[model samples]
Target: MKSNFRHIGLAKLCGWFGISRQAYYQYNWETISSTLEEEMVLMQVRDIRSRHRRMGTRKLYEILHPFLLENQIKIGRDGLFDLLSANHLLVRRRKRRIQTTNSYHRLRKYPNLIREMIPTAINQIWVSDITYWKLGEIHLYISFITDVYSHKIVGYHVG
Candidate 1:
């Protein structure tokens, strides 16, 4: 590629590509500058993470504002996100789901009998569910049986 460019000349090649030689050089310089900026940002991010391991991008960007201004670096929130994502430096969110049932218990497992059942009339099928309501510091368990066809609560118990 270097030999081809030397034989054909860069200005003619740039003209063939519908761009001026200066524009081509400018593009190359922009790439180099962007790479240097990203490297600097990564170093700052690592330094911050060393102090706060679970720091997220938004907080990091906020903390990095002064450093960025001092270093004359310009990067937006989404640009920082992209840089962290590409380099695998982004922090992952923990799953918030609370496990309410243990399916792997040693007790005998019962098959779901209502899998294919569709209620054609009222009282033909009833479905039951248990849920909890938070009352101040206590969780009150509420169990209810509902008529499938009418979509009404037939019976309920709070404990």
Candidate 2:
């Protein structure tokens, strides 16, 4: 059965199964090591990532160094980074901030409606505002209409 399922070569088998040649090679390769050390490193990485989900590799390396030393487990920073990245535990970069404020309109500005007055009933007044958000190359305008009395979003439109 195994011979029937296997092809003449790894590349041929990978091609027959519609798998990437590179992926097939990687799958066949094995790294046998002390499972105890691997588990310890993984647990440390998991705990650090859980506590600080936004921490990068360098910071995590510094944090893990002391703990690993305490347990007499030695692992290089580059190796730790590789381990974290391989296991999909590395932090992703945050998106750059895009300014949405225009302040270029010529329309006359209206006076403040609330004037620090607190509404005690629903529908006492409605406050609305417009903001811009970047979507790809085009700028989108989002308008929000909210009821000041209940602090609820009554209406919203995006264009």
Best by TM-score: 1
Candidate 2 residue 45 Cα shift, in angstroms, is 1.5
TM-score for each predicted model, relative to the true structure: 0.62, 0.41
What's the lDDT for residue 22 in model 2?
Answer: 89
Q: Per-residue lDDT for 62-123 in model 1, tens only?
A: 99999999999999999999999999999999987675766688999889998899879999
Q: After superposition, how far is residue 155 of candidate 1 from its true place, in Å?
A: 17
Model 1, residue 20: distance off in Å is 0.0
**Pairs that clash in candidate 1:** none
Q: lDDT tens digits, residues 16-128, model 2?
A: 99998887766655233345676888998888778888999888889888888898776898888887788888888999877656767998877886898888899888989
**What's model 2's TM-score?**
0.41
The CA lDDT at 9 in model 2 is 82
| Each prediction's whole-model lDDT (CA) | 0.93, 0.81
